[model samples]
Target: MHGGGAVLELAELAFRELALFAAFGFLLGALDNLAIDLLWLRRMIRRLAGRRDAAPWAIADLPAPDRPGRHAVFIPAWDEAAVIRAMLENTVWRFAGQDYRLFVGCYPNDPATRAEIEAVARRAANVRMVVCPDPGPTTKADCLNTLWRALEREEADSGTRFKSVILHDAEDVVHPEEIALFDRLIERHDLVQIPVVPLPHPRSRWVAGHYCDEFAEAHGKDLVIRDSLHAGVPSAGVGCALARDALGALAAERGGLPFDADSLTEDYELGLSLAERGRSGTFVRCRGGDSQGLIAVQAHFPATLAEAVRQKTRWVAGIALYGWERLGWHGGVADFWMRVRDRSTILAALVLLAAYLAMLIGFVLLIAALATDYTLPPMTPVLALLLGINFGLLLWRLAVRAMFTGFVYGRREAMRAVPRAIVSNIIAMIAARRAMTHYVFARRDRPPAWDKTRHIFPETAVPRP
Candidate 1:
């Protein structure tokens, strides 16, 4: 009986310690969320107080160019035969009248993707395929570098310089007015990013729909705040345009290779690099001519748990781990704060794991105390206050997430956001584990490989406007 009682006492002690740790973690997370929440509230108050009559810029307000300047769209493909043709066809058909050229990069080993690109190029005069000198499965940045070289050669041969170079992916549904938008905005902004909205999946609401939730909040609120704060706006990898001068400067900085061939998230690094050099980057969100809100890019995200986890693992590895090593801690106060936010995923994942473990232990202790008539110690005032604040902050975060998700998606998806957040948390934990493993290997001098995810393109025609 004494041994059993001793074990019970130890169990309670462990539970108390775990709760304390969780409370500390929750405090940190709540503090971070509070900052963003306060910023958003301030913006809302300012908007309500002052600009009630003025409207944001609409796509229709921009004057049609007398002659469209040459613009290059770079798509780096490797084993993307499944969606490359559809993407190319949609892009060509949508921008039929615009003086834009589609430059596709393919490897010698990936003949299937090259064939798909060639098939689309055969029908579209403006589409061209640039074959890479290397074999298949190289980094996307390497493929982009190959395309950049091809763009230089094309400019030399045709004696027409492209005003801006746009980046996109194989499965993206390009907006009809996106080229025109880039053409107009590149004049003022050295780098222009458009919001990316992930299309809802009919079958995989939890896996794919989580992406919709994230992007909706990110593109809708976070990026807006980032721009307002004058902290850099990072590229979404697709639907972003880089001015010719900006691209040239980047290439000159690295001796002809504009994109970082070694970085997993080169697109993200590119945006920060431009900002570091004092180049202006803007995120444009506007209504299209058809009276519908138009985001620059829309595509299907990973529709399965495995695929989603794999993709997120790559992202975490690139942004949180490798980015810290390469970029270091450089920038202004806002920039440093954003970087901290970006790198906090690993800590967040650990906190989540701790919270779950604590909940399980606490539940067991609650049952034990009821049966044995032994009560756990009362909560301290400080811990109780922290827990209360954490709960409130969590609800606020959920409400913000739901607001953004509902604005883009309907009310139904927004309702699912709360439950779907759990799925995202689980994914984050898994991805964090995988990312740490990859980072460990990388630190030991192992080169990072392209962990590409298979993409899907919707069969039906994409909604335009």
Candidate 2:
């Protein structure tokens, strides 16, 4: 009985310590989020004070050029046979008359993907496949570099210089008006990123739907604030356009290879590098003909838990671990702060895991104490205060998530965001663990490799409205 009492006491102490740690971590995260929220709030206040029309710009306001400058669309494929055909077909169908060419990059080993791209290229006059010299499974950046070289050759042969370059994945559902939007925006901004909305999965709500929730919040609020603050807008890899001049400058700086082949998140680094060079980028949220929000790129994310884990692990590795090693902590205060927020995923995941464990253990202990007729000590005032603050912060976080999700998706999906956050937290914990392990092993001798996730393009096309 004495030993049992002692064990209970130790467990209680452990619970208290865990709670303290989690509360502290949560406070730090809340502070960072609050900073962003405050900045966004300030912008809203200023806009309101100026009484400026907050209406979204209509797509018709930006007319397509009569003589559109040539734009090159880069699609990098590896084992993407399942969706590449659909993607290319959609691209051709959407931008039939636009002065743009779809340049697809494929590997020699991925014959199925190559075949599909070839079939599409043969069908469409504007579509061309650029086969990489090297075999399969190289980084996406390498494939992009190969496509860049092919673009140069095409320019040399055809005497048509592409004014802008757009990057996209094989599974993306290309927006019909994106080319026109890019055509107009690239003239002003060096890099332009449109909102990327993940289409809701019909079956896998928990796993795939989480992506919708995240992106809705990220592109809707986070990126908007980042752009408003004059901090760089990181490229979302798809639905992003770079001016030809910017690409040329980057290539000249990097031995004629604009994309960093060694980096896992080259798209992200590219935007930052351009910003460092005093180039401008913007995140445009425009309206379509129906006065509804449109001009956003849409795609399906991973539908399974395993696939989500695989994709997020690569993101954590690239953005959090490898990014810190490569980019370091540089730039102005806002830039440095955003970088810290970006890299906080690893620590955030650990804290979440700890919080969940602490809750479970505490619940079990409470039940055990009641059964044994033993009472645990009362919570300290300071600990209670911390818990109250954390509870409020959690509620605020959930409300913000729901607001963003509802705004992009619908009210039904917004309600789901509250519970779906648990799914996201679990995936983050698992991905962080895998990412750290991979990064440690990669530091020895191996370089960062492309961790490809299988993509599924939806059968029924639901165009972005």
Error of 1 at 242 (Å): 0.7
Model 1, 451: alpha-carbon shift in Å?
Answer: 1.0
Model 2: per-residue lDDT, tens digit, 1-465?
A: 313477787888788888888989999998788777777677667766764543235677665654469899999999999999988888788887889988999998889998998897887899989999988788899999999999999999998889899999999988888888888878888999999999999999999999999999888778888887678778989999999989999999999999998898999888888888889988877766654457888899999999999999989988999888888877788788789888999999989987988898799788887787777678878889989998999899999899989998899999999999999999999999999998887764554667889899888862342
lDDT per residue for candidate 1 within 1-465, as digits (tens), equals: 213387777776776777778889878887886788788778777765766432245887665655457899999888899999888888887888988889999989988898999997888889999998978777889889999999999999999899999999999998888888888778878898999999999999999999999999888777777777778888889999999889998899899989988888999988988998999988877767776566459999999999999999989988998889888887799889888888889988988988888788878777777777777667779878878988888898898899889998989999999899999999999999999998886654544566788888988754353
Judged by lDDT against the true structure, how good is candidate 2? 0.87
Question: What lDDT is reached at residue 355 by model 2?
Answer: 90
If scored against the real structure, what TM-score would every candidate get? 0.94, 0.94
What TM-score does model 1 achieve against the real structure? 0.94
Q: Which pairs clash in the backbone of model 2?
A: none
Residue-level lDDT for 267 in candidate 1:
90
